[model samples]
Target chain A: MENYIPVLLLLGFAIIVASSILVLSWWLGPKKPLAVKLSAYECGVNAEGSPHAPFASKFYLVAVMFLLVDVEAAFFFPWALVYKESLQLGPILFVALVIYVAIFALGLFYIIKKDCLRLR
Target chain B: MNTVDIAILVAKTLLFYLIVLHVVPIMVWVERRGAALIQDRPGPNRVGPFGLLQPVADFVKFIFKEDPIPTGANRGLFLVAPALILIPASLTLAVLPFGDKVKLFGREILLQVADLDIAILYVLAIGSLGIYGILFGGWASGNKFSLMGALRASSQVISYEIPLGLAAVGAVAVYGTFSLREIALAQDGLWFGWLPRWGIFLQPVGFWLFFIASFAETNRLPFDLPETEAELVAGYHTEYGSMKFGMFMMAEYMNLTTISGVMVTLFFGGWHLPFVADAMLLKWIGSQNLLGLVQVVIFLTKVAIFLCVFVWVRWTVPRFRFDQLMRITWGRLIPLGIVNLLVTAGVMLWLGGWK
Candidate 1:
């Protein structure tokens, strides 16, 4: 708990710096808001369509795949730290990791087989 | 913790902030000059001697330019996005061990702000949060291009992060501890009386995977599809101006510095120069405080080299197509990272164990 003081202080400092600069800019910069100037920029062309339109399922697929692999990758850190110690204890832990990886690898294989990563 | 401990922590945090603030401007100068050198042109040479004061001029311009919020923009988010990016980038620096502890004034002082036990996990988790700035800024801008840019940035960061985390796991497997200070200390000796016992030598594949993923993670060229000027204009920050834009730019360079610092801490042996023995240095310096300062200097020098490499790569490589970026992350880097981790595990088992 004591180790976190600096982290908390650092966060406060960042917020202060960011806010100060922003406030400074607001105080110093001119603010003459014309109707045309405030409109969202669309590369010199008038804005078209809604920004809230639905995106492709591929992005969602990518996000799902990322969650699966990323969580799997997260497990590796703790496993790596204790892997050597566990190996000395017995092959049980090692085999457990292998089985865990194998299960995910099969999922990855299925995803690839389905061409889910393809950008259609 | 005592008063002295609190004092040291505060001092170290202040020092870290100053170092980051100083480095950001230097990086801006380097990027401009380096891009010029690579493209065979004069760049920003009019401001100060060799254009060293260009960042200062740019800073003044950013402060004075009017920041316009789009009429339909989410004003709250638009205002907070820059700071959101900057916070995590700065926070990631807290766990990085810039140098070993030094004795000063009858006590010991560490060069790092916070030397956490689970430094790697802390860094990875904080680093991933940086994408939120882009996401919020883009979505709130109410611009189609900004939204597209935000999507690209978030997806790219998320995809590459898997490989980055895995590569780090490979190194951790070899090093056996997540404490960055210990990892740096572990690489203190020579492997064969000639070669430095750096993480790069031991985990070459991990280093390569980390190197590529870091480029994507930092949103540099070849992976900077999010801000590819040919398509998205200025990308997520397109709706921003004045110091708001400066905040994003500063955050990017700060991220570069922090990432490079982490890379040096992990793969390049932190504060140890190749072929220089710590014992010899201790004997020569005869003061722990001075030696620690030397170590900090050494660490900064390595980070500087990495920063230069970042700029050089940015100028050299062309932006990858969005599809290419996704394909490379999911197809090549992630798979390679897994293979590298497996091989590392196999070797660790064969060696009996990691110390």
Candidate 2:
């Protein structure tokens, strides 16, 4: 909490800038709203059934799952950069990271074989 | 504080702040001009000398533009988003060492805002938070495009910041230092007194990883998915107008600064101008007085060069598809970051630098 000054300062700046922009845009930018214009844009086609229609879960599911594994793989990057220097940090951390990566990779392979990414 | 101290402090702060503001416009000019050259067209020639006043014209145009709040949007968050980003953008500079030193009034001064022991970690944490502005801006805008942009912004930042941190760890391993000044000074001389500058010569892979990761972290082209114009309109700030738009612009330039600063501190030797033939030039020119002016200039020049790179690439390279972006971060970059880290650690351990 004591060292929160920097974070706090940053938050304050964000709040200040965000508010000013909203106000300025409201005051200065053009404005015209017709029912058709306000409706969800469907790329020049007639109105869609609903703007908030539910999307198929598969695309998003694959995306999230990919991100999960993707993020996991990214975790290895930092550790790997420090790999040769691992003795200073702790010898076993490298081995642990290796095991961790192996397990993580196994999950990836399982998903790959299961065909989670296939678009049918 | 004494009168002299108070006067000096105020003068320094004002100068620093003003310079920070001024840098963005120069960067903008250079970017446009460089892009024009890259694309084989005149970028901006109408306004003033070398199109220098274009940013100023842009500022005037933006300020006069109307502000509009969507009828049912989250007004507070919409307004707060840009603030969140620009703040972190500026604060990261607090710990960067501009140069060795400068002298004034018979006293030496440090060119940095502050030198905390945990400078690197502070930069990482601050960098991570810059995304909140985009997140809030997009969320608050209440447009589907804005929301999509915000989500993409956070996701991309999270993915890229990891490798950026990892690459820097290799530098730390070899130098055994987290202080930016320490890192710069350590890289000052040639290995055999005539070899070359340093850092890049020793840790080329680490430098490349760090440089690439910084590019991606700043959301520049090839990695700029948050505001991917083709996909998400104008991205996070799609609903923004007037000053809110200005904030986004300001943050973009500042983020560019932050990335450049970090790059110089980590990879290039910061403010250590080579080809100096005189000892007095190194001594007198390095006093806190001369340093405050020289340090900022040196730093800005390095940053400006990189800003041109940003523009050059923006004009030259088409942005990656989302799948490709994800693949690069997850497959190529992360593994490379880890490998680089391991190699650095191995060398450091062998050299007894670890103990």
Which candidate wins on TM-score? 1
RMSD of 1: 1.3
Find the candidate with the highest DockQ and give its number: 1
| Candidate 1: tens digits of C-alpha lDDT, residues A1-120 | 777889998888888888899899999999999979999888788887787677777778888989888888888888888876677786666677778778767877887888977865
**What are the per-residue Cα lDDT tens digits for candidate 2 across A1-120?**
323443344344445645665566566666675555544333555543432244445446555764676567545544544454556565565567557756775775676577653433
> For all candidates listed, what's the TM-score of chain B alone?
0.98, 0.92
**Distance from true position, residue B169, model 2, in Å?**
1.1
Q: For residue B121, what is the lDDT in candidate 2?
A: 71
In model 1, the runs with Cα more than 4 Å from the true position are none
Q: Is the docking of candidate 1 incorrect, acceptable, medium or high quality?
A: medium
Work out the TM-score per prediction: 0.98, 0.81
Per-residue lDDT of candidate 2, residues B1-355 (tens digit) = 5677545555544455456666778877887788888888988988998788998898778877756666546878766677777778767766677766566665555566555566777788787888888888777765677777777777677767767776776676666667777877776655556764556765788778777777677888878888888887788877776666777777788778777877877777777655432244558765445645665677778877877777878778888766666556656676677677666655655665533
lDDT of 1 by residue, B123-236 (tens): 899998999999999999888888888988998899999989988988888888898988999989788699998999888998988889899898998799889888999889
